[model samples]
Target chain A: MGLAVILCLITWFVLVNSRKMAPLPVSPTSAMVLVPPPTLTPLPTPTIYVSPTPTQRPGLPPASGGIQVGGYVQITGTSGAGLRLRSGAGLEFDPKFLGMDSEVFEVKEGPVEANGITWWYLVAPYDESRSGWAASNYLQIVTTQP
Target chain B: MDIRPAEITANRANSIVTIQWNDGHRSAYPFGLLRAACPCASCRGGHENMSAEPDAEVFSTVLPESPATRIRSVEAAGSYAIIIEWEDGHHYGIYNWHYLRALCPCEECRSRFGEAV
Candidate 1:
């Protein structure tokens, strides 16, 4: 008799909890009103990046042909004859000065093509007036010793 | 080296000017380029702004088609330079051989000078 009473109470408790847990029925119109609207996201804009000429990197050895516009370079491959620095970028321009072998210079301008030769404008660090265009064949990048 | 022009010809039909240098190199300049590269003090902004080289900006500047860009005539100034007269009555630019050669608008010249057109 006591066991039968315990089983009946357990059944009663389950039925009561189930009724509380069950979801309430709703109409389609009510469901739509309760739901939030979908959101729209905009796309990101695209960007264009232009590569710089004579690109440089950190902690790396200078390029063999790194005679850049703002970098330093040394005269080479001219033997002892010296490289002729011209008033302009072409071979036709008058020679402004003669750059000796291994003389260091700062690149001021040029990569101008003339007479089928590549020319660069170099300026002596010691003398600004001693500047002119020299062939790229006789130039080498000057790298700092670490 | 002294550079001089062996010949200069204007093709109004093509709106191009050709200069054959004594060094055997030839430079072809557009009418607008010659006007934009005018070495006159006024065109250059001031007398102090005059330079042996053409301003690097001229290679990319595209002036509108007008009287300023039309070449009325090209005259030799002594033996060293040439004066260009424009249809707009502006004829003060004296382009020397050095300046003209430097102003060459070839792929080689533009690339070496770090400019674009």
Candidate 2:
């Protein structure tokens, strides 16, 4: 009976001590949690620009010479010196204005023989105020009116 | 006042026709103005429509560059009037001294004669 009481008491003390022990410490690699990176907003697409191309008129011959009444002409062959526009066909008439090189003008009246030169009356398109007679030497026909 | 032109000169270089009056006053008329104010019976639309003064519309009218507006010659009619021949071959306008004075576009004349004349 004394031997049985001793063994029972020892077992009870061991159970109490086992219950008081702390849990095991966690490892750093095993404790890590997988998280996704934050979602990003995308940038707008860039706009592309293209240059304009000149289109050729079909069946129309390129203008070279022969300015007619109601036709359009451009000042050329002046060596950038510009052409003189006079109030009258003759050189005796005062200069109305200086027509710049490559400037376009519409033929209003023309072919007046004066000062041994053929003169054509030219007027600015859409503006009759700027009109005068110009010699044919510097004028290139741009287009003839039908 | 009897206003008579002492001298009439067409400054084609400036496109202005100037008339020097006996009273020491000068009137400069634009080539366009004279063409627009052509006093010919046909230009006035009819003989009955003709008047001593320029029509009210002539002052404000802007005639385009044409043979009708191009002065070929200006001739005296007797001693009181003058005739202007346009390059277009229209020469019936007989501009008298009284009518020409009234047609002056100067500020002073416009104020004195009024724009309607």
TM-score of each: 0.43, 0.44
TM-score evaluated only on chain B, model 1: 0.92
True contacts kept of each: 0.00, 0.00
lDDT of candidate 1 over A31-98, digit per residue (tens): 45555777855422212111221132212225555566876555655544567899888888998767
lDDT per residue for candidate 2 within A98-124, as digits (tens), equals: 765434567889789998989999986
Give per-residue lDDT, candidate 2, residue A124: 66
Clashing pairs in 2: none
Candidate 1 residue-wise lDDT at A11: 100
**Candidate 2 at residue A75, lDDT?**
63
On the 0 to 100 scale, the lDDT of residue A84 in model 1 is 87
The CAPRI quality class of candidate 1 comes to incorrect
**Model 2, range B35-62, lDDT digits (tens) per residue?**
8888889889998999888875666555
Query: What are the chain A TM-scores for all the models, listed individually?
Result: 0.55, 0.56
Candidates' C-alpha lDDT: 0.68, 0.68
Best of the candidates, TM-score = 2
